[model samples]
Target: MWYSISNLLGFGADFGPTTAAGRLLTIGFWMLSLILIATYTAQLTSFLTLKASKSTITGIDDIKNNKVPHSRIGIVIGTSAEEYFLKTISQGSTNYYHLSTTQDIFIKLLDNSIDVAVASGASAIYAINNLYCKLTLVGEPFYATSIAIDLPRVWQYKQSLDVQILQLTESGELERISAKYFNTLTCGSSSSDESSSKKMEVQSLAGLFLTYACVSVIAILLHLWLKLKRHL
Candidate 1:
């Protein structure tokens, strides 16, 4: 049944479902399968591309200021860096192009389609030293994040995975991977002055919210107190 849907939807060209109902049921499965496949494929490609170009990216801010050329920067769609760069950094750079696979980005870089690439700095470091690409950090770091291994929730494997990941992190394997590609001195530094400004903005916003909430509570309490005194 699912095989028929795969055939009708042009999903699994290699396999076919025997029943019509099975094919219909497969429509949903096929759609989900396609989505997952594309996502995984993009990740795999991105990893390969990052591996190839980690040495060449230079740093995060170069891509923002058009220092790397508008056509040269590579970024994955829907990634946090992509969102931050497009919304906050690459304001006037019309030459920028969005890429899905990191592998494609690196290929483009190698082919001279792009001059710089941005991804997780940690992954960039891993690719740089191990991949042996000729590249260097162009400027300061961009954003920072910690990586964790996600395990299946079935049978309560979270604790085991956490321990294993902690061991890997504590043993310095993670740092070792980072030290290979990135300049150990500034691997995770924020690339732009604006980042500091953003931090200020966030703090200010938090303060404003807290103040407003407190004022609202005080006003409500005062109104209730006045109403009770009148009743008395």
Candidate 2:
């Protein structure tokens, strides 16, 4: 049982099996090895053929330290993103260019008018995946906040609205709605194709193929030796 397990994992025994049961185990080992080899080859081939996208800037620090001028940093007017950057990144200075909408943010980026933009995580990701194919999101989220409905203090339906919102949240309706929008903006198919084309290279899988070739040659030689011994 131990020998079978060890061989199954590709750790061949030093001595040949002498008993019928041991030989059977050895056969099982060979079968497992062949399956593993085939599986690895297929995966390696796919990996070599796929490409990856590379981003120039990875985070807010990159934007801050980048030699790009301050005017190139875009911020949507009257947004939390704008407030956050003004208070934290820009240090109370209004050096960034102002834009009225999220669409304008991506348009400016595509035109090279803005080197970077401060916006909500969801908005940024949506634009990058759905609107601007060339844009990429990088780094961890800087500020964490909740999305909630705001109401005036004297609103008569506030209690009813709160109860309904709570019900939606607890019943998973809100999550489903959010997922619908997220799925639309994921951009999986296009990004995958673009990445596959960019990253894959023949040299990446050379080592895997070399190892497989060496193993195949050894197996062939062993089979020939066994055939000659049977005849003698």
Highest TM-score model number: 2
Cα miss at 168, model 2 (Å)?
1.3
For 75-188, candidate 2 gives per-residue lDDT tens digits of 898888888887777788887899989889889988988987877757566668776777766676888756767789799999999899899999999899877765475555
lDDT of 1: 0.57
Per-model C-alpha RMSD: 27.9, 11.1
Each prediction's TM-score versus the true structure:
0.43, 0.56
Assess candidate 2 and give its TM-score to the true structure.
Answer: 0.56
Candidate 1 segments exceeding 4 Å error:
1-59, 91-95, 167-232
Candidate 1, 90-190: lDDT as tens digits = 76343566788656655666777766667654555555534534433456555666555555657577778779878988999877875655545342333
lDDT of each: 0.57, 0.72
